[model samples]
Target: MALWILCLLVVLGMGFNMVSGQGEDPFGPEGGRRREMVPAMFIFGDSLIDNGNNNDLPSFAKANYFPYGIDFNGGPTGRFSNGYTMVDEIAELLGLPLIPAYSEASGDQVLHGVNYASAAAGILDITGRNFVGRIPFDQQIRNFQNTLDQITDNLGAVDAAQALARCIFFVGMGSNDYLNNYLMPNYPTRNQYNGQQYADLLVQQYTQQLKTLYNLGARKFVLAGLGRMGCIPSILAQSTAGSCSEEVNQLVLPFNANVKAMLNSLNVNLPGARFIYIEIAHLFEDLIANSKIYGFSVVNRACCGIGRNRGQITCLPFQTPCENRDQYVFWDAFHPTEKVNIIMARKAFNGDTSIVYPMNIEQLANIDIEPN
Candidate 1:
């Protein structure tokens, strides 16, 4: 019965892609004129999208060793995947080069953008204390403010604001606020509030942080919602039968719901703010359910990890990973493979309203903001 359901989902997915013209290559024709969709792309979040930001941080959450980034151009560049991250693909689709990490970005590089995401970072400042040295969301904002100051120093306040107004502020946060803090045994968050209350608390803080970005000159926003956290290798490994923890899955819905509502409210309240929500959870669930159609043969295990489902421990240094990395959905206990990232990024870039609510990244980029 489950097999039949999965087959049905694949059929539906294929048909939807065909109708939506999503099957076409997004990189454009060879030697074609490549036009940038936005002036710059400022990124924030945790390891799922962190390129090399956490490499220098004294944190256990770091992934600067072998078996990580095995498929990328520069091997082991602190990405928690075998190859490209979602944002990397998004940058390519937008006709821009890869956005450098804030720690490494310098000189004229700041004109394109910087990624401030850190491994184990979360919406709450104290959420990733277990990792030590992880930069929380608030601190990431401050880092961006510093970047903005440098840009303003070079371009002057009015010109900097004009350039920033045309940039894309891509934020994908809150996963660790659950995986590392609320759900961890050492944390007291679980006992402090119920699921709904915890979600409300996170979004409330999130709203202020985003508004701070807006006040600092961000006008176009692409807010990525959390994926199916319970289905990740780490959470699945916790089950005796290697099944997804439905309880963990249920815990995050309130957060996604509150985030969607918050983005909608921000759109109407904040002038010139065009905030869109990426249905990441929905897209991930689809990919997992219809794995075969998407060319993923292993949906439950990591390509490079230890123990049952290769999930008991994350990928280690110099470990031999599965050769057929493209067939796996995950590269580690918690992060998706480059293949999955590519699919997700492409969808968010050009997918219809069902995947990216209010508007897609392409639409958001094309929106012209009146100078203030």
Candidate 2:
């Protein structure tokens, strides 16, 4: 009985290590710099990962204001969260510097990376029309192509292809397609197709979008799947019972599943492709299910919004957020707290197949691909 109990305890410890990292820091010893895992990391996504790409655009999804960056070093650089984003944390783990937004990047900054992620961006062109001036996924891809053109100009085609082949392309999209398009009463997406049909359509377009990036010399890819949208503060605010809307949760499952299958197919079909999927939905589910274990006390309300559940609207310009920001699961109506982002990023960096599929970011970065 004693031996059996010890074995059970060891198994439980391993599981916890998988969820929360194994306490390994990718950063090296004190006073010494570790070599970056990849040459650069290009980001493509929406508000969840948008550093400041939408600040200049005439869009309602901007977050360049007080309280938004209260916890960050430089105040409110247009990140939608209180501090670092998941991509930011991932960048640090890869030993790369914080990538600048494409709108702000210039000169040698492009050598490291450029974030083309924009607030309210989506898989479909018209997904965020309500926000007006927001860049969609297709436009973001064009922006990447523009960056590639400049890289080729500087390094020449051969060196540019080799450099890009070693860089990591991190793409997190599709959230806004549901949040601001299909789910919105003002949009015609729901009327045009049901949930399953819409998922297929989005995945079809998404596959092509990824292929374009691949053709442009991207070899390593980290595609983040959509999370549990129903539990977000915005969706919860619409719930009459102050609980998660199962219908909303059910609506996004097909999209995640289809994306996973798509990634597998891409890896097999696309030459030199190393595509990995991040289980955002499963991570969110585990975090919410074991909130206390993760130190999140407030899971249902926003830390800085107005109206019911503090989610009727996102944070106002100078609104003061909760004092215990780290204890809250969400920072605003549609985004997770920086703490949650940290957890997700760390898991993706070193966790097993359960969190990041086929292989983790650390493994992906270390992959030795022959120049093609």
Q: What's the TM for model 2?
A: 0.91
* Local accuracy of candidate 2 as per-residue lDDT tens digits, 1-372: 121121111111111112243233222344264666776788899999999999999888899999998898898999999999999999989877788898887643544577999999999999988999899999999987865675355445665566667778999999999999999999989999999999999999999999999988888999999999998888888877778889989999999999999999999999889999999988998898999999999999999999878998889999989999999999999999899999999999999999999999999999977546
How much is 328 displaced in model 2, in angstroms? 0.5
Cα lDDT over the full model 2: 0.85
Give TM per candidate.
Answer: 0.90, 0.91
Superposed by TM-score, candidate 2 places the C-alpha of residue 361 at a distance from the truth, in angstroms, of 0.5
- Backbone clashes in model 1, listed as residue pairs: none
Regions more than 4 Å wrong, model 2 = 1-32
| Cα lDDT computed for each candidate against the true fold | 0.84, 0.85
In candidate 1 the C-alpha lDDT for residue 349 amounts to 95
